[model samples]
Target: MVRQFVSSGSTFETQMGYSRAVVAGDWVFVSGTTGFDYSTMTISDDIGEQTRQAFANIAAALEQAGSRLDEVVRVTYVLPDGGLFEQCWPAMRDAFASARPAAMMIEAGLASPEMKIEIEVTALKGSAA
Candidate 1:
């Protein structure tokens, strides 16, 4: 099987020596994605907007890997502030409620102060990988 590398042009991706996602066979492993609009390189101050953008970014990565949000089997979320759970959950539930992928939430600081939330997902497509 050939290993595929994916990048979203996020500075950390190159600097840290990792792709935004990797595809091998039928599995797509997405890296921890922060809530920033790569097109504009901006993060919204509002947690809701940031949460939504983070999922959007994850979805884009999945698309790049020949998968979609509905194919995601697992997800993990990291937050700089645990208190923001209320702010994050609604958006998350809204995004994944239909797909209902197994998910976990944890508290941790991101690389930058401006980053409040980061999300990662694992998707399975086909039955090869």
Candidate 2:
């Protein structure tokens, strides 16, 4: 199948020249997503809250790509502080309990200072075996 691009309607997408997610055949790759609420254009300082928002953003992108978090095959989280990881774990566990995708965490900087976490995911168009 031809590749399909998905958008989250965030200005950063247009500015950065990237799609929120792309679908190539049965695979869906969601771009790295920050916690800023595109609808409100705001970000939270709380790491846990940021983590939740990141997952929600990822879920939306997955849905647009004809997939869902439950179909995710991989997830990667980028955080500025390694110590903040535990705060983000429950959010991950809640979304990933069933999907249980391969996951990795990295310490990294983000686009903005208020942004606490960014998440990226890969999913299959169908359920994982």
Candidate 3:
């Protein structure tokens, strides 16, 4: 078996001593991904938009690791405020509506003040990338 690191154009991972995602054999373990738009380096104040971006970020990382969102086996969400919990589900459902991976949502402050949602996912591939 071998190990590989996956990153999707964000500075935080290196600064935080973490990779965006890691692939070991047939498994890809993605780190908690925030809602920043990597292309613009911007995060929205809206929780719904934040949740959408988080999934987009996670999806990008999974693709880089030679996997897809549909391949995700599990997901964990970190929310700064439970108040916004209701607002996040629609976006979550749309992103993973077909996949429906086992998931959990918990309260936690994200890395930045503007970040309202963060997501981490695990995906399995049939073979190494």
Candidate 4:
């Protein structure tokens, strides 16, 4: 099987020794993505905005991996505060209303205090119709 790695141009990917997503055969596995804009390297304080940005980041990675958000088959969400999960629903629905992949949410501390949320996804290439 052929393998490919996708990057969002985030410095952390290189420093941390990981790709934003990896493609192997027909599967695309996206690493946990945060809200920090890759260009600006800045994150938002609002949970809703962060959630949207994280989806945007994930979408870009998926696109580069010959896949798309609608092809996602599984997703995992991590948040420093579980209470804020409710605030992310609107953005989540907007991003995955169609795919609605099997999902899980975990309440956990992130790499940094300012990091409010992280999301990871798995997609099958050409799975979306």
Candidate 5:
């Protein structure tokens, strides 16, 4: 199949010149997704809630790219505070309960202070890989 893009309808996708997810053949590469609730263009201050929202955002993009969370083959988590990883486990567990995609975490600065977490993932478009 030809390459395709999935848009989250976020203004950043235009301003930043990036898609929420890109589908190239059978693989879908999702961009780093933050906790911003696109509907309201706002984010939660709590790390746990932000983690959940980040996953929700990623899931939405994956769905648009003809994939689902359970099909995710790899996951990358970026956190501004390493200490908050524990706080994010429940949400992560809920999302990856079955698939348990290959995962990694890194401590890094994000775009803004309120943004605590960002998630990026790769999934097979037609099947779980």
Candidate 6:
């Protein structure tokens, strides 16, 4: 099977030796993506806005891998404060209301204090149909 690696131009990817996502056959595995806007390298303080930005980053990676949010089959969310998870529900629902993939959430410390949330996803290419 041919495997392809997708990059989001984030310096961390290079420094950490990882791709934004990897496509293996019909599967796309997106790395844990944060809310920092790749273009500006800035992140929002609000959890809701951070959540939306994280989803946007994930969507971009999935799109680059020949997949989409609707094709996602599994998702994992990490937040420094579990209580803030509720604040992300609206954005999460908006992004995955269609696919409604199996999901999990974990409370954990992020690399930086400014990083409120990180999301990772797995998608099966063309699975949405």
Best by lDDT: 6
lDDT tens per residue, model 5, 1-129:
788999999888999999999999889999999889988878998999998999899998888887899898899999989998999999999988877888999999999899999999999765653
lDDT tens digits by residue: candidate 3, 63-93: 8998988888899988889788999989988
**Deviation from native of the Cα of residue 83 in model 2, angstroms:** 0.6
> How well does candidate 3 score on lDDT at residue 1?
83
Instruction: Kindly report which residue stretches of model 6 are placed more than 4 angstroms away from their true locations once superposed.
Output: none
Off by over 4 Å in 3: 126-129
lDDT per residue for candidate 4 within 1-129, as digits (tens), equals: 878999898778899999999999999999999998877878999999999999999999998888999999999999999998999999999998889899999999999988899999999988886
The residue-by-residue lDDT of candidate 1 on 1-129, one tens digit each, is: 999998887777778899999999999999998789988878999888999999899889888889888788898988889898788878888877667888899998888998898889888895222
Question: Where's the lowest-lDDT run of ten residues in candidate 2?
Answer: 120-129
Best by TM-score: 6
Candidate 6 local lDDT, 46-95, one digit each (tens): 99999999999999999888889999999999999999899999999999
lDDT of 3: 0.86
Residues 6-43 of candidate 2: C-alpha lDDT, one tens digit per residue: 99987778998999999999999999988887778788
Give candidate 1's error at residue 45 in angstroms.
Answer: 0.8
Candidate 5 has which clashing residue pairs, if any?
Answer: none
- In candidate 1, which residue pairs clash? 26-129
**lDDT of each model, Cα atoms only?**
0.86, 0.89, 0.86, 0.93, 0.90, 0.94
Question: How well does candidate 1 score on lDDT at residue 96?
Answer: 76
TM-score, per-candidate, Cα-based:
0.91, 0.95, 0.92, 0.96, 0.95, 0.97
- For candidate 2, the per-residue lDDT at 125 reads 78
Least accurate 10 contiguous residues by lDDT in model 6 = 33-42
lDDT of 2 at 37: 77
